[model samples]
Target chain A: MAETKTYREALREAMVQEMERDENVILMGEDIGVYGGTHLITDGLIDDWGPKRVMDTPISENGFTGAAVGMAMMGMRPIVEMMTWNFSFLAADQIIQHAAKLRYFSGGQVQIPLVIRGPNGGGVQLSAQHTHSLENFYGHFPGLKVVAPVTPNDVKGMMITAVRDPNPVIFLEAGALYGTKGEVEDGDNAVPFGKARIACEGDDVTLIAYGRQVNLCLRVADTLEEEDGVSAEVIDLRSIRPFDEDAIVASVEKTHRAVAVQEQWRWFGVASEVAAIIQDRAFDYLDAPVERVSGAEVPAPYARNLELAAFPSDKQVANAARRVLYMEEK
Target chain B: MPAENGNGENGGAEARGEGSVATSADRLVDLYREMVTIRRFEEACQRGFRQGKIGGYLHVYTGQEAVAVGFLDSFKEGDRVITAYRDHPHALLLGSDPKNVMAELYGRGSGIVKGKGGSMHLFDVERGMMGGYGIVGGHIPIGVGIAYALKYHETENICQLFLGDGAMSQGAFHEAANLAGLWGKDGQCPCLFIVENNQYGMGTSVERTTAMTDLAAKFDAYGIEHEKVDGMDIEAVLEAAERLTEQVRETGKPYAVEALTYRTAPHGAADFFEKYRSKEEIEEWRQRDPIGILENKLLDSDAADEEKLEEIKGEAKELIDEAVKFADESEQPPIEELYTDVYSGEDEYTGEA
Candidate 1:
């Protein structure tokens, strides 16, 4: 059974269900308790679980995040809210150095069942300091499990899986689409990591993305089918670190061409990895070179027009698909 | 509250209203033996580093033995102990096998943590030695969290968080201290912050690092009660540790103890240039060396004769020698170990492996 839910609700439900299912699961973040969370994803949760489980931490990212790592090491499942992925840079040392490496450094003596989730990428016009797409940045590390879920269903399912997983997970949410509604699974809809979700399947060309960019690719897939009679397959790479190379290779083998899209800079982004993977694994099946549609190389701007311009557009993804399909520029 | 003593000076036995004579001669001898073992173990490490038998940066707990030995004496079964890179003694005191510790330093598979964490990063979770972090201030918040969890679990156990005077300047320390104080209001943070004031952080002295030289008083900003102890004196440290650990455990609140001691050795094995401090300063601190102070007290109290003390030293030497031999003979970690322990369970490693 499934019910319609907002992305925010699905995320909250995952945490609530996990917390209720396992007493060890706790939530800690800035403004997550009494203030009802900066995004209200954990709103009203403190009333149910109380302050011990839904904790409001100080603005010290490194301190609280490191504390979460400690808690996880001591057998607590801590789900930390980053407010937004941009602020996670402050706690990068803890996340990258300790949380990501402690288990390996300790010779697997400790398991860090920890999750750090927050809004990612630019869409609400929060500007440069407040906006970042960190899937590739975090996915670069080996020990971390990075997931960027676009749909409410995947958000809930992956979060459950993340909370249950023994390793640390970097949960990147579609910040701009928090209120977007979708049919989410009823209960225990645990989605495994390292698997890509086939959002829409077609045969002409493969469009690859994750997070909010997945929505854009879906829109682009529709436009490509309606305007150019090109059937585009959208592959949502829900998991980044334990990436689904076989899925991309399989899709590319069938489509014979691919367009990798991302809302991050073209250099060293997830799209680049997709392009690399397609070339490395399915080079013989390619009808043309893989196309990459990426955001403009600029820090996110506060002005809505500039912010929209900074991110990859539906028209851009559609044109990239057209290029990979060897069709008209329009 | 224990009386805060003057900084960088030995707090005499009379300061705590205790005599030099220990109540139990056997216990004093045992403590003396443990301290000697640590000192000998550290001296062997220096030799290993010089002989190229040990790799990576090596920080030994040479002159600051009393602080760990004394404080760890108060360690309860469920309690946890965490510290920075200079963590050999904490592991030893927590009952981690000396051979495994030495083998870890030797980078052998038989080493604790399978030689993954070297001198800077030792972990014996079963013994309540949570970890020995390489980063100076990185482990402060972690220790605070461990304490918070202990209280969260409704246990009377506490976390003995040991850090250097240098780490007090880090934002992690202050932030964690604030959290400790905040959580402690409801008696949820039973963290015992043991500030091992070894004077210098690497090469810079604490005086040069922070305007407020009283490291213990800094905890006042976080509402955590703190005091200083003559770190060179084992009895003074033991007195503070016993009182503070119990207080933290019972109250479920955080406490701080700044043990004013000095590291008579260089900051690292390769730090041969003692340009930071003069030989005179080192010699002065050495006169009040923790081991020497304990030895003098034991001799004065008639706990043991010179011959008996020599026997203890000889035994410690033999023990450390055996540890070194075991480390020397132990094999390197299997190549497959490189891929293991990245994550738990099946598919433990990612990537090519």
Candidate 2:
């Protein structure tokens, strides 16, 4: 039977199950073991897996992450948790240079099959430097795949898939969704890359989102039905590299309207790209110009009120949907 | 960990990094041939690029053939070899078909990396050529990770990593080196870092780029056993590779070799010769060219005559010409192919929706 679990718990379970199944499936990151992960994502893993499998490394992202890349090249399935997206910048050279391009440059002889994952997105006063979007930063690379899982089911499934993937994968977990719970497959569940999931079905307008923004978009969809009678279909984009443009286009073709909701800044955000793709491939079906509900273009603030203002919420998504539904320009 | 390698599955011995014994002149000559092939291949690439027969960032390893050939001499059948973008010579020496390498340069499907990799990146995993990386210091960590797998799979294989002087300054090199040293001490590492200190990292001298010009000395900070070798001398390099690889297998320790060599050509065909270095310095390095030294030695030893050398040159030219023709006739990768291989060929995972 499928059991309900939190995002963090589901992630931990995925790692544990994979480690149990394969001996070479090891994890290395900052405080991932006995420290139980800063987000408690790896709680109780050290005792079960021991020091070799669950490594709590030094603060050197470039060091440990590069080492993990090395290990991955040699056929070990290494999962490197960056602790947070903010810290990955320090190891950007290794991630972009070595991990991502190894396969293509090596003439396809080697497989990085390395996953660098951690909490992403800004919320609850995690100010400035700690709060930035990486969709654009890492998405710029060619060989690497960028994934952001929102639901617990997605968390478990995608993590398993990331472990098995031969290329280097950057798995971004929405920090806000760690406590959110959901039901997952009973055993050995794995979700593929480059696929989008439709969270809710609607007809009037489509709300495309990913990561934590799915929850926010779902809330907006509910509000649109109650107040405006606008049926907003929600599309949860799972993979960014092999982006599901076909899904988004198909959704827009049916709805004739599109509103992309993102927790990241609007400028060059994933939402902006989604809107562009919709307009590019499915522009003829559009009832109105696509609108984007994105986080404010500024450093995330430490203050609770300012932090709330920095990111998109249900009100923003609903308003964006309304704008797309109507002839109004935004 | 309770016997973590539960699958009991492993790749070929080449991936495992195993070594084999050799005390014969035939093998030595074969190693020399490998070096000769690399040297000839590099000169051809330089000529091809100058004539607009190639494209992209082409980093040549003309003067450092001995370093690659020597290491491969000691590299057991199961060992792994990874290096930086300056990788044409490495591929040739590691049993990669010179014609295929040239085909790759011409963008042919028959190339070593199926024409996907040009001069900078070439791969042959079955032959244990891990990769030819584009980024300067990027592949060092990858080499270390391969070593980790050798140990993980309970194999006595070693990883031989090649990088240029510029890569040594990259933080990835330092961090990976330190960790390889630490983990290796406890038996989870089997890597050797070979810094091809060709004096310049794209025009800028090592003395100008790094404070510690002694590249081998930098490994001392990471606690890896390191030594300096005359990269031009094939015998010196072979002896060092044998001793260093043995040390790695026995102690599970990491070592670094600073092959003091020089690049005879510009950083790439795109680069103009006058921007960074002086003509005099370039001329001086040319006087001690690895190929010239070998040619002189062969002439003195009577192991062969000038006619044999000419015949070797003729064969090399014909092979390069054939490679170019094959690559020219080969098809470019299809548009659909762009999405494939971004992940492993895992049967359990479906990447395309």
Chain A fold similarity by TM-score, each prediction: 0.99, 0.97
lDDT of 1 by residue, B1-353 (tens): 11222221222222221424343556666778999999999999999999999999999998999899989999999999999999999999999999999999999999998999999888999999999998879999999999999988888899999999999999889889999999999999999999999999999998899999988999999999999999998888887888899999899999999998999888999896378899999999999998887777666655565767788899999999999999999999999899888888675546866
lDDT of 1 at B104: 96
CA shift of A252, model 2, Å? 4.0
**Which candidate number maximizes DockQ?**
1
- Residues B38-95, model 2: lDDT tens digits: 7667777877777777887777777777778777777788898898788777777677
Q: Local error of candidate 1 at A251, Å?
A: 0.3
Task: Count clashing residue pairs per candidate.
Answer: 0, 14
lDDT per model vs. reference: 0.90, 0.79
- TM-score of model 1, chain A? 0.99
Q: Could you give candidate 2's per-residue lDDT for residues A1-330 as a string of tens digits?
A: 799998988998898888988888999988888888899888888998888899878777988888888788777889998889999999998898778767765666777878899999888578998887787678878778899999999999999988888778899999878998899877788998889999999999999888888888888888888888778899999888768888999999999999888888788888889888987899899989988888888878898999998888777777777777773322
Prediction 1 TM-score vs. true: 0.97
DockQ of 2: 0.50
